[model samples]
Target: MTESKKARSPRKILIFVVAMLLLSGSLRLGSVGIAIASSPEDTEPSTEDGATLECVTDAETQELMALLRERSDRVAEVEATQAQRQKDLVQAEAELLENLNKLEDAETRLAATIQRVDGASSDDVSRLTSVYESMKPKDAALLFEQMNPEFAAGFLAEMSPSAAAGILSGLTAEKAYAISVVLAGRNANAPKI
Candidate 1:
């Protein structure tokens, strides 16, 4: 029994040593495989046998770069055009404002002239009558025809009745009819004032 136990103990030690050596070898081989697989040198271009590898950009990448450049240029052009248009719009607004100011000034001057004429005519009934008498009948009639009926009526009343009648008689038939209608309307709607 002692002899048999000694023999089995030696066999077991030998098997354990062999298993340890196999495990160590397997770990070393696995580490080597990992190192080789992850090495940058393995993926680098090799210089051998007079063969050279050139890396070139793909067509799609080049086309994408060209399109980006074109888009940038178009954006720049649009910005420039918009800036120019804004400048033109500002200039046009300034010109329009200037024209409007000129128009306002002109209107003011015209109103002042009209007021002066009205003042001169209203302040002097004698002068108004003399001017009316001096003018040709036809011219006076035409001028009176264009005046407001109320104003014409007032001016006619201020004139001598004979002079007023003469002018009325000299007026065209249409002018006479319009004046008669205005006069009749005024009489019909006479106020207490």
Candidate 2:
């Protein structure tokens, strides 16, 4: 080969080597890029004036990059978990609120049922009292004798004074006394205030 061809061949080889190194990612070019396959001594950064600067080796940079990637992935995973937890909590809260509303509705319905039952019971008792008041005193006294003293006293207390007195007069002394005692003691333990 001629001298010019020999020289050009070396330049071409150098260019090919640089291109290969760049493609392989072993060599990097930037404002302050480094050769990953270079010696440790060559890893130090320098300026145009040859002033050395602190720098890490390619292996250390790669390790630090790996660690950074790992930390970033962990952070992303944590964020995803937190988001899922938040979503679950919101759903749980909504369910709890719905349950509370259902409970309130049940309570309202229960209150209405109880009030209706109480009103029906009161009406029944009032009608029974009226019927007893219209009966003959001796007839009412006979029925009262077979009733519990407290039960008899409840009916007697609801009657007019004249009707109650007439019924009492017709009852046996023992039954009358027992019913009277129950009526008298009904509010004995009640608060006066």
Candidate 3:
């Protein structure tokens, strides 16, 4: 029993010494790693004296520089694209406003042209009505018979009621009925407004 105790004591002492050495080594490594991780400025490689070669060959340092450069390039590219999009939006807004102004001008001109045509058409109808009123019913009836039913109806409608009645009385019953139908239906589809 005494021999076994002596033997176990030496083994325990050797294990304790080895464990202390390993703990010191691990603590040193941990402090070094912490210093390197804090910031690049803390241990940046420099050769201001031109003779000393700092640890610039470290892969982690090179990878950090590459990542910073890539990020800077991406930011610049995004800013340029944003600027181009703003310019395009401004140009499109200007073009759309110009088109809207041109459309308004065209609409005004069209309205004027329509008013002129309507005035001319009314003047022509007034003149024809006057001519028919001067003629005898029998003569107007002969002329109306040769005219399209729609055309005869339009002329009669433009005249005074008495004159239009005289002209209608002159027409053949079938001709008068057809013209009356056209006149009656002419405004059927007209908008109330």
Best by TM-score: 2
Point out where model 2 deviates above 4 Å.
Answer: 1-54
Q: Write the per-residue lDDT of candidate 2 for residues 1-193, one digit (tens) a residue.
A: 8999999998999999999988767433542354434437556677999998877899999999999999999999999999999999999999999999999999999999999999999888899999999999999888988999999998888999999998999989999999999999999999999
Residues 55-92 of candidate 1: C-alpha lDDT, one tens digit per residue: 55798789989999999999999999999999999999
What are the Cα lDDT values of the candidates? 0.82, 0.91, 0.91
Candidate 2: Cα lDDT at 128: 97
Error of 1 at 107 (Å): 0.9
**Which of 2 and 3 is ahead in TM-score?**
2
Clash number by candidate, in order = 0, 0, 0
TM-score of 3: 0.64
Candidate order by TM-score, decreasing, is 2, 3, 1
lDDT string for model 3 (27-133, tens) is 99999999778757655464877564556567978898999999999999999999999999999999999999999999999999999999998898899889998
